[model samples]
Target: MTIHSVPGDFHIPFDDLKVVARGLVRPECVLALDDGSLVTAHGQGGYSIISSVGEVSHHLAHCDTARKYVPNGIALAPNGKMLFADLGNQYGGIFSLDRHGHLETVLDSVDGTSLPPSNFVMVDEHDVLWFTVSTRNVPRSKSWNHHVRDGFIGVIDGDGARIVADGLGYTNEIAFSPDRRWVYVNETYAQRISRYPLTGSAAKPRLGKRETLVQLSEADLPDGLAFDVAGGLWVTCIASNKVLLVRPDRTVQVIVEDSDPAHVGRIAAGIRESSLEHADMQTPGNSRLGNVSSIAFGGRDMRTAYLGCLLDDCVRSFRSPIPGVALPHRSRRIR
Candidate 1:
């Protein structure tokens, strides 16, 4: 397959974007369906659904309101249910929300240890559930240092929940290669993309030797990941508010950017000095993309790119020249 380079001057301008939905609380992860509907992670408790015509309705989990339920990365199950990674202050787990909004714990602990605040959750083509834990640190912010590396990935299937990989540097989002031969993940603090060879049955999956695919600059702290049909991996950076495309040949291209140069410089310096703090990761005031965290391809042709953000109350949409590789749940009907 020929992987053509994107034009050096090509970029998605802020004026070209359209708001798809509003009144959201930290719509961190977005999933676009074939019917023009979008499901995003709601910071308050559950997931919010946006209709094709721009109607917004939130289905919150029926959980205790005392402790905040911060839903980060979410996935749609084949059984017409929604699975979300709860990044709570005092607890963390993978929860399932049914059509009736009933919340149930799917997997809160692996082996016997309780999970820390989770980061992302995904369902692969085989219907297996995978999740990431950014760190075991109490504050979580402490693990933001490049020297910290306690993050890990776990899987849930017929054999039950267990950690598949560990000792990662602040793991964020994960994606599977189109052919299902490998699984790719982003190590936020490490500023790199790594992949592990996939083997074994779905119930007892094994991740082979880890291989670093792309090493990004300190300024580019990758937060989300998705793939295009042309084999280009799209990554969204947080503080920088930039979207990058890593082509099949592993060359990187800047697809869109909306960062304050001075803000990025400070972040880069902090990362290099190993002194990054919570304050340094805050969204820049001049950001136009709301500190985009994830990118998903929607629309009938899969050319409509929807951006999930941290600071914005709505999901942002722009057109993509290349269609995205349809996710396993894209065609499944939402119950």
Candidate 2:
């Protein structure tokens, strides 16, 4: 199949890009900090310390001796603490960064059992931390079949957290409604967004109602997500190799696409470099849907779009018309 670059009013040209660092990067979530820095929560061969320029730094000094590393989400605190969604082990949990960039476990479990390889972590307005657990047991993957049958969306009250919604088909992402009245999470296996209405109740463990927002097929697996200032949703297409804009009306639009597969750069030496600088290749065709995994806002007004690619081991960015909403405020503490 051929691929073509998607055009839209909110799109920006990929002419001005700055390389910070590269090499074995699995950056899942990105934050365009106020101080002109980009923080990436990358889980790969190992967790990497990264900057906005796409530079990867050394591991945080203080971390437990964990065998594997995979972080699916992250957020920063006003006081400079950073929280990461740790998804490496079977029982995923949350890790934090001290002032010295040392890693520490903040909230790893509920009821004495660790979170099940939780995905995105969102700190809401009340300082409540919200995230998703793909399964209590890691899905066994034999060849292409995934056997993760159950999933849950959860929230942590000041000292405790509970699964608010369950029996979900692989809940992989979590975001609050713009009005703060509902929580939205993408069921990866189901290929749709499931939302739960929320009142101001404390530690609400329930699902009032549900909406299947934007049903995506295997053509697109709903992965990373962020909202625009206008409340529109931005989702990454894991298989389609596109950035999809989901409007309030649930209309899906392809905002960007890669036309030149030949020019597509991969990370080298822990930094983004052109591997085909010497190899002669034909001009890229239109654009083929690929594995575009995650996306976030950056650049001057949070209008820049960054994409996570699963096929290649690097992150890519482009321009967008809308600005990104700031990470919400959520209070979470481990008991």
Candidate 3:
């Protein structure tokens, strides 16, 4: 793995009219709705709906997805149903939603115990819900320290659910490989992306055993990865203040850098919400609003890259050379 300084002249891309939501307080999770509007979960505020151009017009049924912590991850159920993962502040849980944002508890406890921070979520064609529990047990604000242990990947089968993978450290994000045989997760504190083969094995997948698709060091924090239709990864790096295009050959190059982290701080200083290994890496440029927390491909063709910046309270869309994975219909509504 080689790192390039990318001459000082480099610049990360920004939008001409970044979407700021009047109704959203601090958006922690965002998903594209079926009508092309966006469904966002906040740190304290609650869930909201926004326009393609970034207008916050309506609240989704006054739904509250978070507890001590606001919701962290959200996805459309396979049936176009609304499903969001919550950090329950002390424990984690998964909730369901309606277009208007009505809420219903789906699977709150796992393996007879309550959850610790439901960090991420994804649903497949069969309605088998794939989600993450940030930790099996951990304290608030200390989640980063256990990234490699608290992590567990499970499927809520048609009849509710059961734990499938266990003992993941501060697991933060989950996405399926294009072939659907593997689940890729990010260890925010460990600074690596682990790929677990979903062959239905009984044993817990160990970090030592799973392939590390990407690794960041003390300086770089890797977060919010998305797959292009080409099956490659578009990964955000906090330390370098850039997004990377990673190929299967284990080589990476900057897709965009020039991100404004002046407000967030340089890699050495750290971003406010950044995890342990890359704590000082998320600083956003004064003009950037905040660090890019989430990215989605939504447009009629799924070619536009939508960036969700938690700090700024808005979403930005960009034209990418590579196409992105088409999210399932329940969560993706392209107006």
Q: lDDT: which candidate is best?
A: 1
Q: Which stretches in model 2 have alpha-carbon errors above 4 Å?
A: 1-21, 44-56, 61-66, 99-101, 140-149, 202-207, 258-290, 310-313, 329-335
Worst 10 residues of 3 by lDDT: 200-209
Winner on lDDT (1 vs 3): 1
For candidate 1, the per-residue lDDT at 112 reads: 95
Q: Compute the lDDT for candidate 3.
A: 0.61
Q: How would you encode candidate 3's per-residue C-alpha lDDT over 1-335 as one tens digit per residue? A: 33323322333454443454555655656676546677776665246678766667544435443345456677766555566787664666887766655667778887787776687777766656778776665554454542336667777764456776666655677776677567777776566777877664323222224777877654345667777766677676543445666665556666665444343344434323444342332345444536566677766776666666556666666666656776664354422
lDDT of 2 by residue, 1-335 (tens): 22222333454333443333456355666555544455566565224444545565644434556555576677765455677777764567877765465667777777677676767676666667777776665541210112344777777875577777777766777776666677777776456777777765644434577777777653355777878777788887554455778877677776765544333322111111212221221122233322556666766677766665444455566666667766532222111
> Predictions ranked by TM-score, top down?
1, 3, 2
User: How many clashing residue pairs are found in candidate 2?
Assistant: 22
Summarize candidate 1's per-residue lDDT along 257-308 as a digit string, tens digits. 8888888888888887877776666666588788899999989999898999
Please give the lDDT score for candidate 2. Answer: 0.59
Error of 3 at 166 (Å): 2.2
lDDT of each prediction vs. the true structure? 0.87, 0.59, 0.61
Give Cα distance to truth, residue 6, candidate 3, Å: 17
TM-score of 2: 0.75
